[model samples]
Target: MIQNRSLARRGAAVVAAGAAALVLAACGGDGDSDSSAGHGGHKATASASASSSASASASQGQRNAADVAFAQGMIPHHRQAVEMAGLASGRAQSAEVSKLAADIRKAQDPEIKTLSGWLTSWGEDVPAKGAMDHSAHDMGGMMTDGEMTELENASGKAFDTAFMKLMIKHHEGAVEMAKTEQADGAYGPATRMAGEIITSQSAEIEQMNKLLGKD
Candidate 1:
């Protein structure tokens, strides 16, 4: 009877050991599953962050391109107009002609500075110092050096008449260019400014024509 009792106890011990082993295996499996799930979550978060970064980078690049082109094109255009205005201010005999030139200079100088600031911010080259190919693009009403010289040498009524004629042409050209930009320019600020220029310059053109009795 003692032997039989000892055998029964041994059998019970074996069953308990098997049950413990099974429990340990289940716990290990649960740990592995949790670890795998955490790794997957990390991967998903990393992918989302990467996509967001790429989208932001693309948007910034587009903005930079638009800003650069606007500054590059506009700087030279403004410089030429300012030069013409300076000549008009000095040589124009009519009060209307002088005032118009002064107004142009006032408006354009600030615009030039604003555009230059954008160029600097974008790390783009400012206006090139050399002579630009005004002929390459239909730069409206741009005078040659000879034409400007003639205007500078004229006096009295001739100066007034010539200044009015030249300035009218200049403003017309600018209006056309501004219209082009309004249609095609990429940035919000640049397109808006282009529209404004078109409206303002068109009105100025009409005023100058009226002043010259050409209306």
Candidate 2:
């Protein structure tokens, strides 16, 4: 059974709503900070201003629905890829497959952090870490429980073949989603991330296909 994604999204909305009140309070506090000039107050104030500027620069571009959907959708997609990659350790027959898994983890774990940070900064909900609504979100390349079970239960050549095939499909889905993001997303960082995914994963897909003897 698919979980409801609205719950996660709603949680994000509530946090954003609460942040508004905090923002107002912060504005009032900013006005009062200038009154104090003792105990390195000027230095502290300068540091705070610099931090705020950095945050603002990270959030410079206009975020739209496309950006929101891309982040929300891709988080789960990437998580699933990482989970699949985790299965490739001793179970893989091919040394290349094991290295590929490590590479996927290296690339995606930071991206997960990046996406989570963006969602927090944008007042958007980061998708929770557990079960997700794959059907509702219509994420193109998620594995079903049975498929995960099959991969988990397999070993040697069977594992290698299944991992290659499934991962190719997974990469294809991410590439499609990323392309949409590049075409429609308004936020600069989000769009750039999308472009990076397409370039990187498209190459991976081709490599995996060749490994599977599908070339």
Candidate 3:
């Protein structure tokens, strides 16, 4: 009878060991499932974060019609300013006026390229490079062919005076366009350019007035 009781106890121990092994296996599977689920969740979150970032970047640089117009109009306008500046050295008498012309050329030339680049990137039309006829466009500060011709014909102090008068008007026109962009343009870079034009050219206008002895 003692031997039979010993056998029964052994059988019970075997059953208990098997049950414990099964429980451990089940727990291990649960752990693996939880780990896999956590990894999947992380991947999903990363994908969502990446998508949101791309969306934000695209939206921030988006342009409107006003922005397009501002860029397009400014390109030719800046070109004209650069052209006018080029004419100053041979004709202008005032050292200050000559320096101012050089400065205007240096500043607006790069800005013209920048504005053109913006339009190209936006899939918009870049203004044609040439003697742009401003008659058709409502851009402010545009010099007529006659005005430019007249200025070109002048010499010495006469040229300096004409340059100052024309440039002041040109700067005023740029200011008007810039203010319009500041109010209505949607592209961040273009609008900022507009504001810079207003600030810088307005100061230049004041300087031109001084050059003209009007300030």
TM for candidate 2 is 0.71
Candidate 2 C-alpha error for residue 106, in Å: 0.5
Candidates 1 and 2, the one with greater lDDT:
2
lDDT comparing candidate 2 with the true structure:
0.88
lDDT of 3 by residue, 89-191 (tens): 7788889999999999999999998998888888999988884764524579888888889988998999998988999998999999999999998888888
Every candidate's lDDT: 0.77, 0.88, 0.88
After TM-score superposition, the amount by which residue 213's alpha carbon in candidate 2 deviates from its true location, in angstroms, is: 1.3
Instruction: Put down candidate 1 lDDT per residue, 26-105, tens digits, no spaces.
Output: 99999999999999999999999999998876654445454566567777777877887888755677888788888889
Clashing pairs in 1: none
Q: What value does the lDDT take at residue 184 in candidate 2?
A: 91
Which model, 1 or 3, shows the larger lDDT?
Answer: 3
Candidate order by decreasing TM-score: 3, 2, 1
Model 2 lowest lDDT segment of ten: 31-40
Worst 10 residues of 1 by lDDT: 58-67
Clashes of each: 0, 0, 0
